[model samples]
Target: MKVITTSTQTWQAKLAGLLLLCTPLINACTDPSDIGLKLDPEANRIGVFYAEIPLSAYLVATDSLNTTNAGVLVAGGDISDYFGETEATAYSRMAFSTSATKPENEAILDSAKFSLEIGSLTAEDLDETKTFAAHKLTEPILDTAYYNFDQLGFEETPFASGSFMLEENSDTVVFMNIDEALATDLFTKIKDEDPVFDDIFSFRDYFPGFALKGSPSQQTTLHVNPGTNTGFKLYYRNSEEDTISSVYTIYTSSSRHFNGVTNNPTGTPTEIVTEKNKAYDVGALVGSKALLGHLVKLDMEPLSNFLDTLDNVIFNRATLSMGPTENFPDSKMPIQGLIQYFTDDSNKILRREEDNAPYSVQLGTVLQTMTDEDGNVVPAVTSGGTNPLVFNTSEYIYGPANTREGITSYVDALYRTDVMRTDLLLYPAVVSTSGTSIITSSSITRSLREYVVNQNSITLKIYYSKLR
Candidate 1:
C-alpha cells in the first residue's frame, strides 16, 4: 500500500534527531548500575533498524458502548467528510412470545406492520431511498442495560412510516405502515382477553417498545436485524370472517435492546476528538475515527529511546507499517484491519498477567509485493485498492523472555523507569474467521472519511542486536 507521501513532520524531525543522539549516551553512563552488568565476554554483534522512530498519531474518543444486545440494530443518518453527522436510534422491548390466546370470533383489524431485518448497508450509501420511522416508545427499554449514550422518549407521531428500498442480493425487509388508531388498539387487546395479556410484567405496562429511527435526509446507514423476521405485524380478521388472514406478532426482546449514539462533531474531523483520553495530532489536525469512538494512539517512546543507545541489545524483529488514506474508497465497510492494544496513561486497556486479557494484536493485510521499474512483481495498492497493514510487533520488542515470572517483557516494560509506560493502541478492526476461530471486532459501523491513518505510512521496522 504505497501511500507514503511521507511527512508527519517527517517523522517528528527524525525522532528529534534520534532523541538528541541518545540523550548524551544516556547521561554519560559512569554505570550507576545494571547495563545488563556491562556485557562483553566477546560481545560484538550489530544490526539496527528504525524507520524514523517516534511514531505518534491520535484522534481519540469512545466514552461509551455497551449498547445492550448490541447484535447490530443501528438506524440512519450517515455523513462524514471525516466523521461529522452520525445518528442512530433503535431501542427495544416488545415481547409476547407466548401466553395470550383468545381468537375465535370478534378480532377485526386486518393490517398493521413494522418489520426491520436488513442487517447492513452503507458502503458509502448510494441511497435509493430511506425514510423509516416507527416511534411509540414513551420510554422503557430497561430490564437492565443499554449504553452508547443512551436516551429515551418517543411518540412524536410515526406509529410506523416508510420509504424503504434495497433489493440487490435480496432479503432486505423494512416495511412500516401501521397507525390506524395504533392498529386498533392492538386489535382491541387481542380480541378482548386484555389485562395486557397478563404476563411479562403486564406486557411491559401495556406496550413500551419501538423507536427505530432513520431519515437525516437519507445519507444512509441501516444495519437493523431484529431478526426472526423482525416484528409488530397484526392483521387479524374474525368478526365472522369474510377474509383477511390472521397474524399477530410482537417480538424484539432478546433481553431489551439498545443503540442510541448521536455524534455531531460540528463540521468534521471529529471536531478535534475533543477529550476522553485526549491526544490529537495526526496530520491536517486529526484522523482515526470509527463510529464516533475514534482511536489511534501510538507512542513507543521513540522506539524506547532508540533502544536506549544500544549496549549489548537483543530484540530481534518487529514490523508495524500502516495504511488507508490516499483517497480511501473500496469498501464493504469492514475497514479491513488494525486492532493493537496495550495502552496506558489512562487510555486504559492494559491487562495481561497471563489471561487477564488485553495485550492484543492483529494489524492484518499483508501481500504487498512491489518492484516494477521493469523489475516486475506488482500488487501493492493502498487507499481504494488496499493491502498494507502490517503489525507483527515481535512479541513487544522481544527481550529473550526476560526470565518470565509474572511476564514483564515488553522490553522489560520499556526499561522500567519505575513503571507507567507502554503505549501502542490503533483500533479500527474487523477480522472474522470462525470455522477455526479468529473473531476480532470493533470496526465502528460506518467510519469513512477514507477511514484514516496514513500518517505518511507509519513504519517502525526494528530488528535489533548491537554491541560492537
Candidate 2:
C-alpha cells in the first residue's frame, strides 16, 4: 500500500481554499426547504466509494490487567449460560497512620469490625442472596505492582463470613464483625511488640492484608468504593472504668490492591481456547461470542490504494461499518465496542494516554432499535439499515496527509510499509479515565456475529474538493 505525493505547497493551499468554499454550499443545501441555491457537483469534484477489503479477526484472553487507583473494588460471580462463567475477588493492603502510638498494657481489647461502602449492583442481582467471606492474606500486598489475574496466597481459615440479600438493603454500607479470636491475636501482637502503628510498610509486615472473596453463584457483581467507607476498625478500652473507648481504623487505600477476575468457559459450547493463529477469518459463530474477545482486523491496503490515485484531495468523511448477521436480544448484546491497534507483545488493551496519536475508537451503543408496524420494538437488521458498529476513520486516514509536508512524509512512510499500515483491532470497550487506570467490567458479556462487507454494504462516504 502506497500514497503518491506529487503536488506542491501552492497547489495544496489552493485545495484548502476550495474546501472552505464547498463546506458552506454543502451545509446550506442539506435541508430540503433551503435548497434554492444551485451547486455544481462536477465543479466541486466530490466523490464517494464503498471500500472493499479483507478483514482478519479472532479472540484473545485479557489477563493480568492492571488495577491501580481504580476507585472501586469489584467482587462477585456471574455466569452466562451461552458463554461461560466469571468470578471476581478483591485484595487490598490496609494502611494505618505511622504517627499513632500503640495501645498501652492497661487498654482492654474489645471488638473489631470491617465495612465496605457499596457503590452499585446490577439489575439482575437485586433479587438474589449472596455470601462473602474474608480471608487472612499470607503475603504482603506490594504497593508497586499487582494485576487482576494475580493469585495471592492466603490462610485457609476465614476471618469473617456474612450473607446478605440485595433486596433487603436500602443502605449503601455493608458491615461484618471480625472473629474475636483474630482480634485477640492482633491485640496480643500490638501489646507485645509496642510497634509503631504509623507507616504502611511496618503495618503490612505485622498484618499482611485481607482478601474479600464472594461465594460462587450466578448473580450480579458489586462495585465498592475503596477510598472511603472501607476499612478495619479495632475498638479497645483504656481501663474498666473508662467511659469512652479508643478506636483505630486501618484504611484500604489505593496504594497496593487489585481485583482478580477469572472467566471460565467450561460448559459453553464455544469454549474459549487459545488461538494458535492470529490471522484468520472471523466467522459468524466466532463473532457471536465477542465476550470471549473475538476481534476483526481491518486491512488498510484498500484505503491506501484509493488515496494513491488522488491528488490535492481534501477528505470530508471516511467511515467503516460492521453489523451482526442476526438481531440479538438487548440483554445479550453489548452496548459498546472498541477499535484499537493490535500488537502481539502484550494482551492488555492500550489506553489513549500511552499512545502519541489516538489509536483507539469507542463505538458507542451499536444496536439501533425501531418499532414495527404492530408497535413492537426490535433490533434493526434490514437491508439498507444502520450497522451495529460504525467507525469514522477520516481523522486517522486523512489527517496525517492533510498538509503538503505531511503528505510527502506520509507517502515516504507508506512506501516503506513501516509507518503506514491499515491493520486495526476490534474488541470490547474498556474504560480509562484521566487519573485512574483502565477498568474492565467482569459482569457484562457482549456477543454478536461477524460483519461482512460487499458492494451493497455501507460504504466509506468521502466528500472532497479536487484542485482544478
Candidate 3:
C-alpha cells in the first residue's frame, strides 16, 4: 500500500515554537575549556541508558460489526486456539430483471441448482470438506444495513443440503441441487405469466431469499464469493422434440446480503485474557496457547525521572525493544503486528489528514539475533536472549521538542501529552484502505504473543548528548 504524506501546517507551527523555548537551556551548559577538560569532538559525547517496565493488556470483544459491503463473504466453522470456536453463515437475496417473453405453456422444468464460487483459502483449509444446508428465509433481506451478529429468521427445514470437498491447490465452485418441487413451482409461475413474475419486488414477495449455513461439524472455514459468481440457475425445455435447452438465472447482489459470524470463546486463550484481572502474559507461548490481542501501557514516569537526573541533555534517538520469551519459538510467531493508541474507552487514535490526504508513521517488524555459545548466529530464543520487538521511539519522544514549522506535522505532536502512562493496542496487522476513523473488523485478528519478563521485560534504549 502507498503511504500518504500530507499533514496540517498549523499543528507543525505550534510544535516548532515549543521546541525553540527549550534551546536556551541547552546552550546554557558550562564550556568544557573553562573546566580545563580536554574532550574529543566525537568521543563519548552521547550517553546511553536502558530500562524495562511492567506491561498490562486485555482483550476486547466487538460483536456488532457491519459486514454489508465487505468484499468477500465468509462461511464455515473453525476452532482457534486463541478465540475458541467460530461459525459463520451467509444469507443472500437473489433477484433477476427480465424483458424476455414467458416460456411456452408446455415447457418442462428439468432442474435447478445453487452454486457458489470459492475465493481464497487459508493453510488450515487444505483438503477440507464442508457440509452446507440452504434454508428458505422467512423474512425479507431488506436493502438496509446489517451486521455480523444479526440473526435473520429462516425456515426450520432446509430446502437443499450437500457437502463440498475442497481439492488441494484448486479453487472449485460448489453446486447443490434445489428441491425439484420448488423448481417446478417457479417454472409454472414464469410460464403462466403470473403477476408475481412481472417485477423484482413482486418476485421477492413470492421467494424472499435463501440462507446458506455451514454444518456444525465443519473443521475448516471457506471464503464464498456470492456477489460475483454465485446464483441460482433453472434448466427447462420448450418441447421434447426441441434439441437445445433454455436456462434462467438469478444472481445475488451485495446490496441486500449479510454474513453472520459468531465467536465463542468458551475455552480458548481469549477466555483467559478476558477473564484475568491482572497484567496479561503476551508473547509467543501465550499466543500459541490462545490467540489474544494486547493492550500495552508505557510507564513514562520512570523515563521522565531518568531525564531529570541528567543536566543540559539533548536527546538524539530512543528505541523501545521487546521480544518473545526465552522459551517461545519463532515458527509459531505472527509475521506482522499493528500498534495504535487508545483515545477513550471506545475510540482510538487515527492517522492525521489534511485535505483528505492521510499522513502517519509506518511500523516495521524487527527480529532479534545473537551469537550462540558455538559462535553461530541465530534468532535469540534461549535464556539471556534479547526480545525481537524493537520500535523507534524518537519521534514519540524528542520529535515534539524539535519540530520543523512545515516539515514536521503529524510526527511532531504524536506524543505531546504529559500523561504519565499511555495505553497502546497491539493486534495482528490487518490492512485497510477505507480511511475510516474507527477500527473495524478488517483491522482486527486473533494473533498471540508473550513478551520477555523481569530483567528482560520491556526496555528503552536512549542515546543523547550532554551539551557540555
TM for every model, in the order presented, reads 0.36, 0.58, 0.60
True lDDT of residue 441, candidate 2 = 30
lDDT of each: 0.56, 0.48, 0.47
User: Mind sharing the TM-score for model 2?
Assistant: 0.58
* Most lDDT-accurate candidate: 1
Name the runs in model 2 displaced over 4 angstroms.
1-57, 62-72, 81-83, 101-110, 120-123, 142-144, 165-171, 188-193, 196-202, 236-246, 267-272, 275-282, 285-313, 320-339, 342-419, 426-468
Error of 2 at 212 (Å): 2.0
Residues 269-317, model 3: lDDT tens digits: 5565543223444433333211222333333344444444555544444
Q: Candidate 1 vs candidate 2: which has greater TM-score? A: 2
lDDT of 2 by residue, 358-397 (tens): 3332222222233446675423332221112322232111
Candidate 2 residue 193 Cα shift, in angstroms, is 5.9
lDDT of 1 by residue, 1-468 (tens): 111111112455435433333221121222223222233433212223222342666666756646677666777766666667777777777776555454554666767887888756653445466677878788677777666677899888878888866643345777787878877887777677677876667877777877778864566656777755677878666775466577777767464787776877686656756777767763643355455566777766755665565565545445555543434323223345555666766775666443464554322232223344667543232222221132222221111111112112334334433334467676666554545334556655433212554565554544344345
Error of 2 at 17 (Å): 21
Measured by TM-score, the strongest candidate is 3
Q: For residue 26, what is the lDDT in candidate 1? A: 24
What lDDT score is found at residue 201 in candidate 3?
89
By lDDT, the candidates rank as: 1, 2, 3
